[model samples]
Target: MRITLHEVSKGRAGQALPSMSLEFHSGAVRFALAETEQRPTVLGLIASGRMKPDTGRVTIDDTANPKELRRRIALVDAPDVSDPHPDITLAGVVGEELMFAGVGATPLHARRWLTQLGYNELASTPIGNIDPAARVRILCELAVLRDGVDGVVLVAPDRHGGSPDGWWRIAGEFADRGYAMLVIIGGSAAVALERMQEFEAINASGPVQPLVLEAPADADADADAEPADEDAEPELSAAEPAEAAASGPWVAEAVEAPEPDPLEEEAEALREAQGPASSIEASDTDTDTDTTENGAAR
Candidate 1:
């Protein structure tokens, strides 16, 4: 169960999300930086094959079978999309999700299932009042209940107000069970995860490398066409990434790869549109504080 996003981006220029290229396979958790109110959901939708990117494409196991992606990938807790109502009781939420999973869906069944999970005490509480880590755990548990779901895209768990590590550990647990995991989160959460990464981390975050795009499809012919422009693009070939489908367990060496200039140029434009914002690589957590987001869509 591998998932790849090849330069997959949504919206037009100066809009929701910037171009992103990443890969993650089963038993690994991947994170992407998306701070805006809409970027997280947009990325989740695109990654889960529920929506199409305006530019690039989404693939599972190196094939462009989005329909299969829809079946195998579960998009969890995306606001205004898959999220349960804030006012809904925990039991109500469980019952509804159980219905989707084709299980016993009555209130009693939901309560019994909650008991099995040791969460019966919270059954009468509103889902919005659930702790952030517990919320992620419950939603994800229900998500994997679907027949063919082998992976999960958990969107904006940071918005719920908790230590990023709380939900990160929960996601890692699912990945350890052989489910591919992609968590779309704010820049601050991404920074937190990157900072916690050990030299040889066991719970590694997949594909946090610098942006590296693949060479164009007609590389052989195109390479020869620009012979006169050799000095102008001296480092382009070396900067090309490790093919389009490099999906597997997270590796530190791969994340340290240098990026090409073309993606940097486009990313610069994206930054200008986003105002003064920090990238996921920013070491200072203070830099991710977006006062300007009050004026924007945030």
Candidate 2:
């Protein structure tokens, strides 16, 4: 399945945004490295099927009504539209989703699936108590469990301190099942992920261009600020010298690195078990080729 946007534009009469074209395809992973507002708006329009491109159109492979496409297309972590019921348990969330999709699976079935998926410990935990990444994974599974899901669009999934690698692993799992994955991000995270141009889109006109995210004005100013001299220290007033000398020699307090959160550690472990399929090029040697080749061979 594929979702294509041709010169899509939204917003005010003359101020339509993202005037660029985009496409998302099945069994592939793609990202939209855009601004905070731009990513969410475009994601909302695409996922909700309310997006009527002023100059272009969005089409699904075998579907006409975008609203009906909701069953096959899932949206995760989109701003203002992805909050699950906090009072529900993890299993309860799955059960509710199954019901929504008209699947007759019982809550016990949801529990079993969670256990098989290495989330047994969280099965009975309240959705509010679990990590947001876990919730997003559950939501994605909900889409996959439905009869005929084609793809899932994740909007700013990194917003809640969620792991990009974790979602990439989960997307990989679904992609293995022939489902497409669209990951949308903005700001620093978008810049960080801008290098992942391996996945191709159905409607791409040319080569994948590097996403150039500009630093905010204030951030650039801070970056360009001159550094202070190494030996320079602010001078105390002459009148306060005696007081400073009496005050125990200005001992510096040591700051300790914070202990890792157990919840996050468990989430990381779970994500690892799911298998990370994507790697950002942080070092000199290319890890993407290695990971992708290994994954493909498997």
Model 1: colliding residue pairs: none
Candidate 2 Cα RMSD after full superposition onto the native fold (Å): 42.4
lDDT of each prediction vs. the true structure? Answer: 0.88, 0.69
Q: Tens-digit lDDT track for model 2 on 1-298?
A: 7777656666665254556667778878777765745556565556446556665566777355777667667776566666566778888877777786786569787878788778988988888777766766777877677676678887776666765667666667777778888877766766555433333233356766899999999999988999877766555677865546446445355435689999999999998898866566566775434545557732
Instruction: Give the per-residue Cα lDDT of candidate 1 at 172.
Output: 96
The candidate scoring highest on TM-score is 1
lDDT string for model 1 (1-298, tens) is 8888999877778287799888878999989888889989998999999998988888898899999999999999999999999999999999999999999999999999999988999999999999999999999999999999999999999999989889999999999999999999998888888887663284465656688777876986787774575435233345666552244333224545776799789988988998875447657675565566467733
Residue 50 C-alpha lDDT in model 1: 95
Worst 10 residues of 1 by lDDT: 244-253
List where candidate 2 sits over 4 angstroms from the true fold: 13-17, 37-42, 47-50, 62-68, 195-298
Clashing residue pairs in candidate 2, if any? none
Error of 2 at 80 (Å): 2.5
Candidate 1 global TM-score:
0.66
